[model samples]
Target: MLPKPIPPQPGQESVWDYPRPPRLERTAKRLRVVFAGTTIAETTQGWRVLETSHPPVYYFPPADILPDVLVATPRTSYCEWKGMAQYHSVRVGQRIAPDAAWSYPRPTPPFAPIAGYVAFYAAAMDACYVDDELVVPQPGGFYGGWITKDIVGPFKGVPGSWGW
Candidate 1:
């Protein structure tokens, strides 16, 4: 499925565009991200990853994850579309991944659908796989744009992309 409100009247080539669907697209692309020390959070709503800028932050249902040991942090960030997002640190035995996980406690009007879903940074994760095959991490550090084999060279993850 897709999100609602539709996309800009069409024809507009803005970076912040979405193909809203009535329901969330529960793709077969579901994968697991294991951090060095993060625990997944199982919620009634589900696992939602809250991050912003350009791409729509990916949210995974709680039942879809195995959050055995992650620690919540006081860190937070604001997004124009979503709202305020909380942070978490995962601890697997002795190692710990700081702010490896994030969620939106209170989202704005448009993105209330993804209240508790969580998404882990592909770069911070030890490994992410869709069933059997491992997925490549999207190039940017701050942005989680996973790099797949099909993706050609030259990817940008900045605010004002100059020549990207």
Candidate 2:
């Protein structure tokens, strides 16, 4: 059974109200990622994917990310809604976070706007922010959702949440 969703306060959103198929929407919120004392990415032109029981996953356009920081990896994963995803390791100076980011080179039609845009795992980074609010990584390492103050959930990725 699905867990009870937290009641959202004014100006907040509840993830349980999000749709099953996931919706990809453009966002002008300043998204930033920092690792190893370097600002690896910062973008106002980003997309966010929202699905039930999950926090939003922010995607940054390729131009906003530092090119040298991403090292392409052979890893790939299939998502039922987004299509195939390619992984990348994030490297800054001597630090490396393997498979810390992912992108879709060719997404399903509805998600085409995010093609080649990258999304980083907040858990793997020193910090990630939406506007000025620091992000909390989604509960599990498997999902790349960014949990900010304005979002509420009895989110997925927690133990006993798999069947949600």
Candidate 3:
């Protein structure tokens, strides 16, 4: 059975209210990812993907990321709504997080805005900030959503939520 939806507080958004197939929207909020005492990516022009039962996944423009941080991996995954995704490892100084980021190089038509954009897993980075607030990594290693104060969820990535 599907989990019951949580009612969002004022100023908060419930994941249940997000669309089923996911939607990409431009965001002006500051997004930053830090690792190994280095700022790997930062942007005010990121895009966010919102889907039912998940928190928003922010995708930063390639130009905003520091050069040489992302190294492509042989890993790949398929998303029903976004098409094939290519995995990337993040290396900052001597610290390396394998397959910690991903991008859809040739996304499905509806998700083309995210093409060549990179989304990092919050858990893999030392810190991820949305605006001025630190974000919580979405539950489960496989889903790369970032949870913030304004987002409410009985999220899909939690344990025993595989059927969701």
Candidate 4:
């Protein structure tokens, strides 16, 4: 059973209200990812994917990420709403986060705008910010959502949420 969703305060959004098939929306909020003392990616032209019981997963345009930071891996995964996802390892100097980012190179029609756009796992990064607010990584390693103050949830990656 799904846990009760936290009531959202004014100016906040409940993840329970998000749609199941997921919605991809372009956001003007500044998004930034930092690791190993380097700002790996930052952008205002980012996109966010919202799905039921999950915090928003922000995607950055490939052009905005620091060059040579991402190295592709052979690993891939599939999403019912999106399509095949390709994994990438994030590397900066001697620090590396393996399979810490992913992208859908050829997504479903509705998700095409995010093709080649990258999404990083907040847990693997030193910090991730949305509009200057530091984000809490969504619970569990399997999901890559970023939890900000304005987003409320009994998020899917928490223990006992697998069946949600």
**Which lDDT value does model 1 have at 36?**
57
For all candidates in order, the CA lDDT equals 0.53, 0.96, 0.96, 0.96
Better of 1 and 3 by TM-score: 3
Candidate 1 structure quality by residue, lDDT tens digits, 45-132: 3322222123323566656666555578998888665679888776787877788877777777666766766766766778765443
How far is each candidate from the true structure, as Cα RMSD in Å?
7.9, 0.6, 0.6, 0.6
In terms of lDDT, the poorest run of 10 residues in model 1 is: 47-56
Off by over 4 Å in 1: 1-25, 36-56, 149-154, 158-164
Question: For model 2, how does the per-residue alpha-carbon lDDT over 82-158 read when each residue is reduced to its tens digit?
Answer: 99999999999899999999999999999999999999999999999999799999997899999998999988999
Over 1-164, each residue of candidate 4 has an lDDT whose tens digit, in order, gives 67888999999999999998899999999999999999999999999999999999999999999999999999999999999999999999999999999999999999999999999999999999999999999998999999988999888987888999
10 residues in a row with least lDDT, candidate 2? 154-163
lDDT of 3 by residue, 1-164 (tens): 98888889999999999998999999999999999999989999999999999999999999999999999999999999999999999998889999999999999999999999999999999999999799999999989999999999998899999988
Candidate 3 lDDT at 64 equals 99
- Relative to the true structure, candidate 3 has a C-alpha RMSD (angstroms) of 0.6
Candidate 2, which segments miss by more than 4 Å at Cα?
A: none
The TM-score measured for candidate 3 stands at: 0.99
